[model samples]
Target: MALIITDECINCDVCEPECPNSAITQGEEIYEIAPDRCTECVGHYDEPQCVAVCPVDCIPKDPDHVEDEEQLMVKYDKLQAE
Candidate 1:
């Protein structure tokens, strides 16, 4: 599943660089995670780096972009190819 940065995000600036897919970015109000680019670090790490580093523990699986591990890997591969 793609991970989401919730409203609880502290905007501590830790999660952005932790995203291997470069999917996290600053929004108008707070940080945001792009569902299309989020892979939960499927190909980059054993767990989501952003989640690991977030002090607020605001990153959670996105219900709107749920996908299995295989699907996430496929997305990772496609992203890597690009």
Candidate 2:
């Protein structure tokens, strides 16, 4: 599934560069994750880099964009093709 940055985010800027897919960006008040581009690092790493490095632990799977591991892989493959 894609990941989402909750309101708890501290705008620490640690996550944006960590996204292999470039799915994270800075919003007006906090960081945001692009659901279409997010694959939870399925094609890049075993774990999501942002989550691994986040100081506030505010990154979490997007329940609204729910997807299984296979789905995440598919998204990753599509991203690679692009």
Per-prediction CA RMSD (Å): 0.6, 0.6
What's the CA error at residue 61 for candidate 1, in Å? 0.4
TM-scores of the models, in the given order? 0.97, 0.97
Q: How well is each residue in 32-78 modelled by candidate 2, as lDDT tens digits? A: 99999999999889999999999999998889999999999999999
CA deviation > 4 Å runs, candidate 1: none
lDDT of 1 by residue, 1-82 (tens): 8988889987899989888999999998889989889999999999999989988899989999989999999999999999
Clashing pairs in 1: none
Worst 10 residues of 2 by lDDT: 55-64
Q: Residue 36 CA error for candidate 1 (Å)? A: 0.9
lDDT of 1 at 62: 93
